[model samples]
Target chain A: MTKMHMVSALNNALDIAMKADDKIVILGEDVGVDGGVFRVTENLQKNYGEQRVIDTPLAEAGIVGCSIGMSLNGLKPIPEIQFSGFSYQAFHHIKQHMARIRQRTNNTMSCPMVLRAPCSGGIRALEHHSESPESFFIHCQGIRVIMPAGPYDAKGLMLAAIKSEDPVIFLEPKKIYRSFKEDVPEEAYEIELDKANVRKQGTDLTMISWGAMTRLCEETIEDLEKENISVEHIDLRTLWPLDINTLSNSVNKTKKCIIVQEATKSCSLSSEISAQINERCVLNLEAPIQRVTSWDLPFPQFALENYFLPNKTRIKNAVKKVLEF
Target chain B: MAQEQIGQFGINHVSILDKEGNVDEKLASGFTKEQLSEMYYYMNLLRKFDEKLFNLQRSGKIGTYAQTKGQEASEIGSGLALSENDWFVPSFRELGVYLTRKVPKNLLVQAWNGDTRALGNPNHSHNLPISIPIGSQCIHATGIAWASQIKQEKDVTIVYFGEGATSEGDFHEAMNFAGVFNLPIVFFCQRNGWSISTPTTKETKSETIAQKAIAYGFKGIQVDGNDVLAVNKVTTQAIEKARSGDGPTLIESITYRMGDHTTSDDSMKYRTQEEINEWENKDPVLRFEKYITNNNILNEQEKTDIHNAIEREIQEAVEQGLSVEKPNPEQMFEDVFAQMPEMLKEQKEELLNEIIQMSEQNNNGGNQ
Candidate 1:
């Protein structure tokens, strides 16, 4: 095992996959020569040559649409949309073709491609660079949506997403791209899709979150444990095809739950999780489920970003409310 | 400073066969009698199939279908130029291409009837399923060609779209990629005069759709879409150039939409009868039929036999399409993923149990 950050871990994942399969090709804006905007694909073009690692023109729809074509013709293409906010330009291709090709063709043609984008806020970057669009992709059918919080899970999930037969929307939280380091395995490994990780176990309250918010939840759980409140913290590594079984089991044991997310409160993944928990573990619940999320406005600019995002105070307050109820 | 011309480009228009069934003998000499007869047969077959589909929709046997009436030459000529190894990526209105590629007639019927099984296996046939969103398949064709280039394969990819597609950003992006990579692809554009209710003149003011390729650093040519010989000649030359690594070519075939945009449309509301009459005089199928007769490529007896055979084949296809069983509800859960996740499995099971419970309730009520 070696210590690495999220960017290095993701780059290692790409290197390993490309070395194992010649059919794997990476293409996007600035992916070659410059590695990537976040340098997640550094040294890939140098190692794989320009053919396998392409530097395409600045057209998101073309990048995604062409990748769909490449995947259709027997190549496993991983196309990166520069930012999650700009993915809307390619949303037509993603929602219409990439997600439905297999079902539309009755399994005759499947798109085994992965679309990578750096998502969520806290980077203090320009507008459109800090938006969380996981809920948009989770609502789409026939595609897997994944978001990995740390270096270890990033490498494992990236490899699994590359090997998956179905199309995957891999959302990398840019805020933590290089914020911290972890001892990740050197060899290839796969963390199964549609499975959540139990970061810490407790019997008092259950806190569910994903992406960068999971790190905040970890800190909050540390503080709560010191205050004599036991909390079960779960990181939803895969957003779609959710591991509801794990969630229900944890909620049943804790009997109080709080969902934290970076996206707006309306029609987000948190809403879905809250509704599912209410349906499945309502009888076991000791209090009403609380959701701590960003307000239902457009993601604010950098000045108000910290205020807009769910902070530790907000999460602890939600936890207190659920416990007291 | 003095002003000078930076670049000069010219677009060429090709028309070897005329409306009067006369051809420039030298330009048409490359085609054998068999090839000419085959092209004529496909054109006739497409027209017949188109009429039958119209009747089927009228009788409520199938859903709305986009007809391929006057553009038969544009579809069949370019389709026949392709080798089986080459890919045929098409927009929704190329039934003639499917016929040329030997896609089953029953599958075509089923596709129009909204059956999923009609998509067939694209890997086996080297043809993509019809794209409905308009102009999106061009980029796919470029990517396929790019893949072939990367693998150092000689296979070329040919993509078909309509005139209105030229106005789309995807079309321009596809052209740019083909130019930049020098990929082996042919952008076959059918200038079918109308995109639904809107005419081509309103879609773009570029004088001709073929010239758009010049900006992308490639050759663009306009062919009389009603002239099967000209379309065949240009497409053949374009495919050869692509195979030889000469890069992509854009061929604009000029034709008219002889029918409505689809069964759901009424062309009479927007188009004048006189304009329709003018195009009807230059019908592609009639022109090809006359050419075959004038050249002695097919005799009257042979023509009658071909028609009779086509009628029988259409009948069999209709029967086969109609006789297909309704798909099981559980089949919907399949193909969404390579492996059904536990969540989906539970949902499928719940749906099945719900169906069973409803049936059981009905049975108990009947006994009471």
Candidate 2:
């Protein structure tokens, strides 16, 4: 085991994948000599050469569109869009081509590419840097969307996404890229997608979240445990092919659910999860599925971001409402 | 260091054949009489196929179709320049390119009918499916060339798009990458004057689309797109340069959009008859046929035989395209992933159950 941060785990995964497969390539703006703006790709260009680890011009659409072409031509490209907000430039390629290529070409061709971007808020980043756009991708059919909350799952899920046949959107939580450390394995491994991780098991109420919000949910669960509130905390590692069976099972046991998300409340992944849980575990419900999420308004300036994002107090209140009901 | 004019860059316009069957013997030597005759045959065949598909759309047999009427030379000439091993990336309106690449005619028709199975490009064919969204395929072509370069392969990639695509950010980004990395690729821009309702003059104030490449650090050539010989000549040179590791070149074939953007659009709404009439006199196939007839390269009997054979072939292709069975509706949920995820599997089952119930109801009605 090696102690590493989320960025290091992702870099290590790329190194391992590139060394194993000659077809693997890495490209994005500032991904080469600058080693990405966050240095997540530091020293990779030197190791893999400039051809494989490319520093593209500042064009998100080109970076992604070219990567789709490379993927079509038997190259496993992991194109990085600098931020989730900036990924809108490539959304046309992502939705029109990357997600639909497999279905468009039938089983003849598949886009084995991973579009990596930093997502969610809390870093006090400038506009277009801190945004949780997972719902936009999760809503895109035929694309696998996965976000890792820590280093261990970061390496595993990164490897799994790189190795998947269809296109995968690997949204890395920028808030935790360097926030914490974990003992991640040096060897290559894969944590299966479409599976949820049970961070803590309880029976009073089920708290479901993913990405940065999972950390807040964990903290909220710990704080509520002091009041003998046995809140079950589930981190949904994969958002698209959601592990609803696990969520439904938890909801059946707890009889209540509260979804936490960093994105706006309308048509969010949280809304989908809540609807699914309602469909599966409505008879077992003790209260309505509450959502602790950001407001529907545009993400405000950095100073007001804390208020925009879901906090421990809001999550605790949601859990208390479900338990009290 | 004071900036001084160290060098001069000027765009060269190329045209090997005139509208009245006159040819430049010096530049026309590269093509054999037989090859020149074949180009005419293919160009005629493409027109016939396009006409048939337009009729099919009118009859509700297919969806919206993008016609490549006047721009045949720009598509076929550039497509024929690349070797078999090289890659071809096509925008939506490259019917001539698809024919030159030997993509099955039935599949092209099937694609217009909204069937995904029609896009099953043969294995190792190196031909990308038609990109409907304009300018997106340019970057794909650059990346394919970059991959071939990394693998030390001699293959060059050719990407096709219209003059209006130059306004897209993907085009600039692709050209910038090709210039900076020296990737082996060709950007074939058919400047067909109109992009839907907007004219090229409104799209960009630049005098020529070819000059856009100069800003990205490469050579750009303006070719008479209606002249098949000129399009083929420059494209061959560009492909050779790219394959030999000399980097990319942008060829802007100056043509006019003789047809509407697609079946759903009306050219009469945006363009003038005078402009269309001006381009009709410089028809690519007619010019090539004139040259062939003037040189006696293909005798009258041979020309008649080629036309008859192409008509027969088009008839067979139309039959095959119409006869192909429709794809199973359930196939939609099957290929979304390598393995259907649990959620999709449940949804598929739910759909299957509904389909079964509906079919059973139909069977009961038939019995009654």
Candidate 3:
């Protein structure tokens, strides 16, 4: 095993999927000879031929809509919706057809495809470029949604997403594309899409999060531990179809759970999990399931970003509140 | 198909069949009596189905249905024109043609009844999901068409939409892709005059909806949609052209919505009584019936018998639709994806248990 960044991990995952299935194809705005804006798809076209790696026009609907057709025709398509925010352009296609085709068609056909979006804040990108819209997709029923927190998880989850029999939205955290490195397995291995990994186990309290938020919480847990305050950190691999068993078990042991997410707190995935915990495991709770999430406001640019995102201080305070209660 | 992909600067209408049960001998040679009769019978069935479903809506048995009254000839004729290997992609309003392609009669009723389960089978042919948002299927059709072309398959894709859909960006992008790649597709538009309350005149001021093809460097046709013969004629030529490697052809079946856009809509709100009367005179089904009967192809008795048979069959279909067990409200959770995540499964179980507990309490008749 060798350590690699998120982009390298993604490259290895594509190498794995493409090698396994000849029907697998990669398409996006600049995914062809130019590799892609982020170079995540670098060397794909060269390895697999131009027919498999297509450089589509700058039309999100065309990219996603056409891929649905291609997938229906028995070809596997991995479409890149350049930026997470840019995916909104193809929202109708995804939410309406891509997500519901299997159910609407009564399981006679499945749109087995993957939509890879480089998502979330921390990258000082364009206005719409950095946004966490996993909650929007979680509201949709038929598609699998996952946000990988690191290089290893990205490699494993992307493979699982591609191999799955249904549509999956694989959100790659742009902020962590090159932020961290870990030695991924030399032999390709798949990490399940519906399970969250235990980043650290502590008995005092549990901190649940996904994507870039997990890294911040991981850092916060380090400092929190120094003050004799221990926290259980969970890196949610998949957002929708959440690994509630793992989350509930941790909440049962710790007796308190704090969910951290980059999206606004209202009507978010965090809200769904909070409601579920209250309804399912309310008796075991010590205090209310605290949420360390973004305020319900349009994400501001760099200046006020620290005030918006859940960082070490905010998370530590939430941990302090739950402990005191 | 490439041989027929000629760049026409104006309308390229290619019709041979006429309203008076007449056909141009040159194009008629390809069709047999059996094929034409099947199309005739199917179109009749569609008209009858529309008649009964509307009545059911009035009686509150089924939900609203978009009438295919003046557009059956267009849908039936065009759908019949495609080869078996070719694809048929349609919007929600075109369920009549979708049924023609073998979407079950029960499914048609179930879908309108709010059971999306009605649209559940595709083993019959290449049909995309019924699109509620107009014109979106056009791009999917184009993509499927290109997939065939790229793979060098002897197939094509035919997309159906209304004239109002031309205004959508999806329509523009689909046409652009069809033109650029010269994909084997037919952009079959049913120009049923009215986008709900808005008339076609307000939808676009273009001289003809078919003329929009000129913007994308392809041939376009303006057909008298009420005449089944004309719809069949242009559709056959377009299908042949696409089969021979010609790019997409835009055929605008110029017709009118003879009934309300849906059961809940009031056509009187948007169109005048006089306009409705004029289009009623040009109803596609009536035009075809007049042509067939006046020519002695199908006598009055034969027409009555067919209509009676269709009505009885539709009644049976309604019974079949309603006869099923009270739908599994739990179906809302099943088949969401190929598999439910453990959490959803548990959530579903919890919901079921909660319902069971509620039912138990309600049996005591004081749970409110």
DockQ of each: 0.72, 0.71, 0.58
Candidate 2 stretches greater than 4 Å from native? B1-7, B361-368
True contacts kept of each: 0.67, 0.70, 0.65
**lDDT, model 1, position B73:** 92
Please give the CA lDDT of all the candidate structures.
Answer: 0.92, 0.88, 0.83
lDDT per residue for candidate 1 within B1-368, as digits (tens), equals 99999988899999988888888999988999889878878998999999999999999999999999999999999999999899999999999999999998988999999887788555455789999988999998898898888889899999999988998899999999999889999999999999998999899999999999999999999999999999989999999999999999999999988999999999999999999999999999888887889888899998898898899999999999878986677877887888988888999999999889888989889642
TM-score of each: 0.98, 0.97, 0.92
Residue-wise C-alpha lDDT for candidate 3, range B1-368, written one tens digit per residue: 35675543667555555554565667656666566667667888888888878888889888767777778878888877877677888886775677667766876887778786666665664766677788888887877787787577878888988988999988988898788778899998888888888778888989898898888888889887876777887888888999998788999998777888888888887679998888776667766666566556666787687778777778888888766655676776787778777766777998899888889889988745
- For residue A190, give model 2's deviation from the true position in Å: 1.4
lDDT of 2 by residue, A154-185 (tens): 99999988888889999988989998899999
**How far does residue A115 in candidate 1 sit from its true spot (Å)?**
0.9
Better of 2 and 3 by TM-score: 2
Q: Highest DockQ among the candidates is held by which one? A: 1
Best by lDDT: 1
| Number of clashes recorded per candidate | 0, 0, 7
The lDDT, on a scale of 0 to 1, for candidate 2 is 0.88
DockQ of 2: 0.71
Question: Local error of candidate 1 at B153, Å?
Answer: 1.7
Model 1 chain A lowest lDDT segment of ten? A99-108
